[model samples]
Target chain A: MNMNFLLLLLDGLKGTVILSLLTFLVGGTAGFIVALSRLSPFAPLRIAAQLWTQVVQGIPLLVIMGIVYFGPAIYGIFAVPPLIAATIAMAIWASAYLGEIWYGCLRSVNKPQWEAAECLGLTRWQRMSRVILPQALRLAIPPTVGFMVIIVKNTSISSLVVGYAELSYNAKVINNSSFEPFLYFGLAGLFYFLVCYPLSVQARALERKLNVANR
Target chain B: MSPIVEMRELRKSFGAVDVLKGVTFDVERGQVAAIIGQSGSGKSTALRCIDHLEKINGGELTVCGHALHTDKPDLAALRKDVGIVFQGYNLFPHLTVGQNITMAPKLVHRRSRKEADEIGREMIAKVGLADRWDYYPEQLSGGQQQRVAIARSLAMQPKLMLFDEVTSALDPKLTGEVLRVMEKLASEGMTMILVTHEMQFARNVADKVIYMRDGRVHEMGGPEILSQPSTPELADFVNEEF
Candidate 1:
């Protein structure tokens, strides 16, 4: 309810946005590589990508943040900033899941499209870039936008483990000072909704547009 | 001149079941050969092998002077020379009809956008779909989509074309429209191999008719073979409605 506290939360919202955007930029690039590796003809590359997704999916993000933030200290390198650690941890975690999502999208493209491209004598790279990826990208947009909402929400997990001053962390600080869990947490939830609801709505709109086009 | 496609004792198997057993055939330049047979008789499989869609277990296949029997065949070169159309008309659903037609020419053939677009328009006009060039595959009817697919293949200017039951999924009117396109292609002296159930079209348009039985060429000759009883298998196949 306090204006100062509201400003504090707004400042924290900035941190959340920065962290989510940075994590997605890093994660999305890695995720694209992971998705292509999962579909790679080379056996070892596919296995390595599969193992990465499995390991990251198996571990909780809180644990990953802890390891990323603290594990380097045990190796005598303690200068790792909380923001950098959290970003690295979140990028790794997000890439695994995003990679899996996109892998499914790439595979969802009909097999005949691949055959058609091959019969046209397109090389492997040409087939993927020109024929296959263009189609897969269309199928991927709705889910990829939907996943951004998850990424934004998941940034809060860094506050719990890495002590990153994101929205949830600032809310906790406010609650500690005011001893008002209801007021602070409620405002935090509101801030999250403000950021994520638009993404969810946009994702749905894209899905409908794609379906109509397909029809 | 060497044939566009030459297969001698070509054999293919799916696990333990042999689909094309020692199938031998040759398609000369500008010739349309129709391969007809019952289901599981390897007509489609043989057509597919020419495109390297199916790997052969034994024997020889040479298409456009590239030997396909080798472990590392020049598949890109082979495919550049061969264009294949399936019964499903597997056009890229996301791209416009013009984009679909120009994809291979622009990417594989390295044609400039203007050149590809010119060929796209030419092929679209050839298929009588000039008005629908900008439309998506989902917007077109099945027959129109199939014709766009034919134009897509033609844009590559392939030396030989393969059709695998391209009209099997079409209604009678749609089939007639697609068959008419093929007849037009044949009249233009495009080299083609078609695996078809349309006996009448084979009789009328195909320069050579190869009747396959259990993966071997049971009888092969000109269109006259359709009426003559050179073999009982051919006679039975001709009399029966596929």
Candidate 2:
């Protein structure tokens, strides 16, 4: 493999890392709202959130990326930068999965906690903020971190559509020139493994900590 | 004795089934009132309605001289004055015992952390749980957790306290410890409404004992109600244990 090709691989590493961080931060926030909406007492909000998750989850990531890449220009809108499109696409994807993860966490809180909060005379908002969210956050932490690793890995697919120059995109560029499929692809896979393995480990560790504490 | 809590012709139903049907009761200040009944008799529902946990379908409930659901009852404020301890000891699992005790005061009352912490420790100590201040709910035994829950309510400095079969989740040995905490609270002249099956606890502690059957107050009195029980329902309930 050429030295220039390896450098491209390194640039892809930067893209993957930056995009994953942005998705986790921005997408995690968006997902929290979506989760809350999905769990809303109002039927319309719940349906809207549920439909959004369903639609997002059902479509292929590649299709979503294409729509994200090209859909905005249909209204004579300004074109999105490649990085922005990738980030937006990944964030939307993260919101759907994270929303589902968090909703399950919120539901898993003990039933008695709700009744106890109600009896304490907590208003609905107070009950959620003070009593419910704190506990839900604990339950949510492990799965959320775990999902973040998935988000990081899936961002690789952005190479196909956005021209984002992420790890996979750079690897493709290098592979085109080198024609050495095994070496470059394996290196790309190694880059991904390097980025994701520690997060996977951290998430599992946190989950074990939660389980032991709960026990 | 002047009534502090009054429920008149109160009605509540879930879907098509009636849980409370024209139920009425009055609780006096500084009095310990225990509603004793079999499961599903609406004893717990009555307590819940008094605390406004269950929305009433029709009728009136006044707590500490204020009408519930009038002009959108400041629920947080009402809750501060009316504290409830549940059967499951619903202490917030993520928060420490001190945090659980201080949550209402700090959030609802806007007490400073320092003030809330100081008071939380005091309440925990009062319940004999000072050592468990930093412990989470899951760390403590069932009885210890219930005592901490009672302390959590006490931290609110409530005018009225409700216990919904608080000892039901505990073993017989642990039951006495929790009941003793209640006994102490009652001796301190706190107005309390307890829904419990512990006949001896009711006979010994309650200023008023109400025997509920099928959502209505079937019979009521002091120790005399327990001693001279006449109705077959009450007789059957009393005989089951004695």
Candidate 3:
């Protein structure tokens, strides 16, 4: 309820930061691969990527975390750490959503743009890297930053069932012992806002810049 | 050498809608063949087929010595010898006029940055936009964008160039600017096929005019054919344009 509780919550802050960063890096890469697959010329890759997006999106985040926590143990792969399990579930969750968001962005590029790139004799990857992705990246920044906020907040869900000692988890434990839910939880919310507000501002600034350039 | 492009009954369909039904034509090297037609006459579709943009469902299409009829045509090689400009002026919006022209050249030809910049400046100058190298597509007027688009294609130095109504989206003055650049390319003897509504430009510049009607070449002959049409459909079409 005192300085000790504040210090303990700060210790928990370390895990949340690490978990969020790892999740973003891992998920962003996987999501990009998934988005490309969705747009792949090969039919099977496109179908499989479509299926992955649908199935992952349909499941609840809590269940996904639970499955990651216990699903492996059923197959004799036990002792997966809470943090690692949470990271996997979070990544899987973020990939499907980000993949869909980005696929829409990429496809939104004008059809003639694709034809123009192809007609220029660029290899497939060259067209993507030099033309399409640069344009799509502009459309993607706002939603992607918005999703990072979701990712930060979603880390709290991991603590509920998987027992990961992230920010919200330690705050909950401290409040349980001291019976001071208002101050600790309020402080936790403040920390969450502090982490996410700068990202939102940057996204808005980038979006404005892109719009002005487009204008 | 064989003709730069030979289309014998080339066919294309989109979900039971036959866009190019047995379309046939030939374009010789250094020949400017203007394809004039209405919206549904499949001129753009046919132009796109030369670069394997749209697969021909039946018959033969050969461009720059590559047969385009096969299931797995070497599109990369074919495209290397071909460049296309679209009605929408599909210049990469994120890139400056200079970069838009130089990007493919740098990637495909692997030229040094200095050489690429030289190519960019030269091509941009050829298109009469030498001063606007740093301008982005959105910054340019439609006509200017179309000119930049032409310059982008010209930088590739393709054996054949296809313009699918390059000036269709521009105002008369802007279209004139774009047409002037294209006229310079024609004067330079670049083999070109253009699907255009500009009957006057076609009459003046095209060596051969293919007046397409209903996905078929209704009339084909020298530029003189534009003034004296052999078919009622072409005469009507040309009359409407004038």
Candidate 4:
């Protein structure tokens, strides 16, 4: 095996970083809408959001990626790029979980906050934008940030379905050629740790800050 | 001047339980009425019903001659005319004192930032917290936060204020501070409906005192009624350990 392990590792690390960043950016925004939709006044909107979350949670990530990669073609649209398919799949997954996380925070806002805003002559939209969302976002920050680390880590699975050249995919390719499972996998795990640990720490620190602010 | 709010035969229930039954009251312009009651006597529910926060199962509610029970009772207009100070102070913790005061004015009144800021600063000064405008709710003492909550409500220029046990959650010293602001408001002729157990403050600040018992108005009269302490039920209940 004349493979360069270091080159494979570098390439994989880049994939991990790119995929995680893209997923976080796109996924976070989509998740916000899902969260708000789950709380919508329209019963159909609420049910749609709820069903979307349940369906995403039930399906395996690999199957979802496959569906995303292929489903767009049935409509005769442009061929969904492998990276785009993986990102969309990851975003769907993230929206479900993040929506649930934020819905919990939004509900945690004491009932009086809603009543107080209502008495202040605010419409439902005004109550949400002015009174409720500001408070909910504070409670949501820590958990949302924490869930982002999961989003980052899950990007590794994009390698399984799309065979995207993410760190995990590169490591598997390198190990198959060189037969050095321990070294290649260990390096891949190290790269994952390097990317995720700081985020985990920041999430925890933000959680502490939220607690203090709430207290 | 006309009565600003009137609730006639108001009735509300939740499933098998009745929270308020055939409750009747009127709040006249520039009059402060204090409603005192034991826990679960429907004082809070009545106040919520007035705000349409809880729709009455049956009865007529009118605010400034406009009916409150209609399908669309001009909610924004009604709420604009009525402000509330909650038991928990409920100041938006994420916002500074100034922002909290200015929020509804800017959002509901569509006041410009400059105008709202000026009003917020002026009210903060009135509440004796001009220096604390930039501070967050958590940074202030409970009393100070409650004062800011009052100022926030005042910024809306409400025709009536509903205070639900505003000082119940505060320390004794803090309660005094909050009551002082309220007393000042009452003196300034702001119509207010307050739910409280502070016998002294109610007697001193209110033009009328209402006692609620078992989801109904048990008694209503001048401040002298509370001072004399007539009913055995009232005396027993007030003295009982909660």
Candidate 5:
């Protein structure tokens, strides 16, 4: 591709990175809360968190973006900025999957650890933060990194309907005028592979290292 | 002072199964009581109830002046006064031995870092693992990890300590080392309750020996009762143990 084509793609990559980071920050925080809620002693909170996961997983990321992007304007009410709308949809979607993944990690830490923490007079918060989370976080790294790869790729779908100016969106616009679909889209595909393949490799490495420790 | 622990007809049920049926026992301060029984005899369940790890379904339970039979006992306060170690060791796998020993002191007791470090060192030394303070739980053998678990409990400075089949998981060599730490603690006059299969250790170290059968105290007396035949069931039980 030409320098101009390369620059446009670089700009799109920046949008994707920013979206992915924001999604991880916002959605990762929510996912932690949801994971805690899933294990919460209160039945209602546990049930509500379960419902949230079920409902979100039932809807695709594209549909979620459409609902957040268009559902607001369809009401002809308060308008959301495209970036904000995309972040909100992508974050909500990530929280459900991340929460479920994290809940499994949390539960996998072993039952006696909970009892031991409790017998030590640790407050529930201390028990979670100090004792349980440290172990769970180890098991969570691989799956969480794997999920982020999914998040980076899914940010592309956000541009299709939400008009977020991400990599594929920019490539499509450039290809429409230039009529060089293969060159531009191919380059966009390579950029995604560059960003995502490392994460997958890292996830695999962490899984192996941690499973050995666990054994 | 009154007994450090008093269970007046304490009853605990897991659904339709009554694990502890109207069990009553008392452990005075500085007394090491050994609870010896078969797998289903509820020795472990009784020890668990003393710390309120398992809720009692019927009767009164009091530990370190905290009555636990009620709906809401001050668990934080009760736990501050009681410590329990499980057979699994249950050491926080990610933390170093020093961190595992210091966690409760720092978090629950809110000891400063310097003070917590001091406590961690002292407790680990008591378990004869002073040099391994920086090592992770996984780095230690089963016996060493169990020793670290004991040190973790000791850092809390509880009024009572409970050991639920602590040495049951270790080999004979490892079990001896762990039991030595426990024997040292008993000599120091720690108020302790242990559920153990080690009949010899029970006879030598325990001030009181309780024999449970069918989720009830079938026979109870001094350590000598282990050698003496008070009941046919206990006689048979002790014979089988030997």
Candidate 6:
């Protein structure tokens, strides 16, 4: 209810947004590469990518944050910032899930399309870029937008280990000082909803629009 | 003159089953050859092997002067000279008909956008879908989509075209439209090889007819071979409703 409390929450919200965007940008690029490698013709490359996804998905995110934050110091590089450490951990976590999601989307493209492109004499890259990727990207959009909500929520975990001071962290601080748990926590929840609701709506809209078979 | 496509004792096996067992055939320049047979007779497999869509296990195979029996054939160059259309009409659903037709010419041939669009329009007109150039594959009927698919292949100016049951998915009315376009291509002196169920189209349009049975050329001759098949397999295949 107080101005100072509101300002603290808003400041934390900014950090949350920045962290999510940065993690997604880094993670999304890495995920795309992983997805391509999973589908690569070479057995070793595909196995390597598959191993990465399996290992990343197997570990917990909080543990990943701790290791990333502390793993550098074990090597005698002690200058690692909390924000950088948290971002690195979150990115690794996200790329595994996103890579799997995108790999499924890429595979969902009909087999005949690949054949058609092959018969046209398009190179391997051309078949992917001109035919396979375009269709896969359309199918990928809805799930990708839905994944953004997960990214926004997951940023909160960074605050637990590294104390990155995102919305949840600030809410805990405000509640401890004022002893008004309901007010601060409710306000934090509202901020999270405001950030995530639009993405959910957009994802649903894309699912309907891209469902061309029914149309 | 050398044939556009020549297969001498070509063999292909999927696991334990042999699909194309020592199939021998030739498709000459400016000739239309139709391979007709019952299902599972390897007519489609033979067509796919010509485009190098299916790798051959043994024997000699050549298309557009490129030998395919080698470990590393120049597939890109071979494909550039050869075009293929499938029964499914695998037009990129996300792209418009014009975009689909112009993709190869622009990318593979490196044609300018203006030149590609010009070629797109010409091929679209050739298939009687000039007005539907901007439509997506899903927006068109099954037959129209197949026509657009044909145009997409034709835009590359291939030396030879292969069609694998291209009209098998269509109703009789729609099939007529597609067969008419193919008939026109035959009259224009374009070399083509088609695996079709439409015996009437084969008799009317194909200069040569091949009847495949159990992965071999059972009977092959001029269009009259349909009416007067020398072998019982060819006679049974020609008389069947499929």
Off by over 4 Å in 1: none
C-alpha TM-scores of all predictions: 0.97, 0.95, 0.96, 0.92, 0.97, 0.97
| Docking quality (DockQ) for each candidate | 0.84, 0.65, 0.90, 0.73, 0.90, 0.90
Top DockQ hit: 3
Measured over all alpha carbons after superposition, the RMSD of each candidate to the real structure, in angstroms, is: 1.4, 1.9, 1.5, 2.6, 1.3, 1.4
**Residue A185 Cα positional deviation in candidate 1, in Å, after optimal superposition:** 1.1
| TM-score, cand. 4 vs. native | 0.92
Regarding lDDT, does 2 or 4 come out ahead?
Answer: 2
- Model 6: per-residue lDDT, tens digit, A1-215? 78998999999999999999989999999999999999999999999999999999999999999899888888997947888988899999999999999999999999999999998888899999999998899889999999999999989988888888889889988998999999999999999999999999999999998885525
Per-residue CA lDDT of model 3 for A1-215, tens digit only, reads: 49898888887788788889988988889999999999999999999999999999999999999899989987897868898999999999999999999999999998888888988888888989989999999899988988888899899998997888999999999988988888999989888889889988988888898777666
Write down the worst ten-residue block by lDDT for model 2 chain A. Answer: A115-124
In order of TM-score, best first, we have 5, 6, 1, 3, 2, 4
Better of 2 and 5 by DockQ: 5
lDDT ranking of the models? 5, 1, 6, 3, 2, 4
Candidate 4 lDDT over B1-242, as tens digits, reads 66898888889998999988889888889999999888999999998787778877888899866788777787777888888898888887778999888888988899999999999998999999999989988899999999999999999998899998999899899999999999999999999999997888987889988888888888888887775658877667556622
- For residues A5-61, what per-residue lDDT tens digits would candidate 4 score against the true structure? 878788889988888888877877887888889889899999998998898899988
How large is the interface RMSD of candidate 2?
1.7
- Interface RMSD, every prediction, one decimal place: 0.9, 1.7, 0.7, 1.3, 0.6, 0.6
Which pairs clash in model 2?
Answer: A12-A167
> For residues A93-116, what per-residue lDDT tens digits would candidate 1 score against the true structure?
999999999999999989999998
Q: Which pairs of residues clash in candidate 6, taking residues 3 or more apart in a chain or in different chains?
A: none
Model 2: what TM-score? 0.95
State the fnat of model 2: 0.71
